[model samples]
Target: MKQDLRAVIIDDETNAREALSNLLRLVCPEVEICGEAKNADLGIEVIKEQKPNLVFLDIQMPGKSGFDLLASFEKVDFGIIFTTAYQEFAIRAFRFSAIDYLLKPIDPDELQAAVEKYKSQTAGLNPQQIQILQQQLDTPGTVRLVNRQKNDNQRIALPTAEGIHFVQMTDIIQCESLGSYTKFHLIKGPAIVVSRLLKEYEEILDNYYFFRVHQSNIINLEHIKRYVKGDGGQVWMSDNTEIEVSRRRKEEFLSLLSDFYVNSGKLK
Candidate 1:
């Protein structure tokens, strides 16, 4: 009554590759292991040839790294689940990319969960959003635009090469709401003004990386330095900025933190 999902495994180590393939076949029999690649180049070739529905990607490889390989591709037709050996920065980068990932010495349960999440998210994804996600996977960073007011109309222009100032999404500490305007606090330079509501930006940002921790603040989970608990809960950003977690959003925030750490395999 269900369909089989085709998958390919890409890892430099033969043992790891085979082990993952075997595990998938054993636990998730519905997942067909189409092929395996020992390096990024070969993996890309196989992916192009097989066109599987999913890919179990390894972060590190011989010639090109997983990130490099992903960047080279113009489009990603398959869902990706990155497998790595506990690199904190890479994991954070993947989180920012809004892609599903798993830690090395992979657990069957976690792998299953990742697959399920992928299925749900991709089911109703719009073509534009898919394109945006693919673009972000290849080139990850913050986006800025200019707003112009003429008469009673407003026009927006994409930041140009001459006027362009690029900031990594991870560099964003928090977004502050002032009246109808939102100010972005970055790791460098002055905060920029954009004529958009906090809710608007929140909707644009991929939910896997950013969370609405409070009514006025949306914090990047990767930038959270610490979580301070007291009469009310608060999160400390990498820049030493504090953000309140509203009582209404407390449970959801805690659940996100729990899932993040759990998926990273810091918790059993």
Candidate 2:
């Protein structure tokens, strides 16, 4: 028999908790509702007392937000599936950190997917990664990405067949689209194919100064070795991969290159 996965729902509203609990009851028979809490304080207490294996945490509460709740914990041992109302920034942040989340008015399909993802990530998160998630939430505005932090090891979480792997953003030379999957080429690692679209990764990596020179490719701006003008354009990547830029996207790519070079003081 499959063991029931214990879960606790932490939300500020009674309706929200009840709705999710009921939804889980209908869709997932393996999930056992261990307890529920109305706020982060009580949520922490329930977490300590019940010690459920999974927590469905609402991002917004009366006093302490979801980020605040996570900050309170010394170490997050169990799985967390965040529930939030749609904020463009929040959505991007979640993708950037590769965290599982359920949007408000949640669909059953998405709920099931989130649960499955949590099951796969049984090991959960460490303290520093958790802190980065907090940083992601607070970060939304676009700024020219610079390697200002000398000691910062900026990595993006990628889900693979083996498990979740964190790849340094700077190490990634380019990304290629394969229908629903996006394959990443890193500096010294084997190519990794993740179950996500190129556009999704493009959105998350663009903020970190990656550029989409083609519909099917997103290359790190710092990894362009040379550009050869063609019908549209061709660029040689640091790893020696050649990417094609569409004519329509050529101007945008050139402008981005201009900005990137100027920002990095490579161009006057």
lDDT of 2 at 156: 76
**Best by the TM-score measure:** 2
**Which runs in model 1 stand beyond 4 Å of their true positions?**
123-268
Span of 10 residues, lowest total lDDT, candidate 1:
146-155
Clashing pairs in 1: none
Q: Tell me the spans in candidate 2 whose CA falls farther than 4 Å from its real position.
A: 117-122, 126-129, 142-153
- For model 1, how does the per-residue alpha-carbon lDDT over 1-268 read when each residue is reduced to its tens digit? 2256788999999889978887787777778889899988998899999988888888767788876677667766667777878554444344323345788888899888877766655342223332333443444333221111011111112122233233456567787887687778877888866655777666555333567888899887767878998655999998888888998888877887776565544453
Error of 2 at 59 (Å): 2.4
* Number of backbone clashes in candidate 1: 0
Q: Cα lDDT of all candidates, in order?
A: 0.66, 0.81
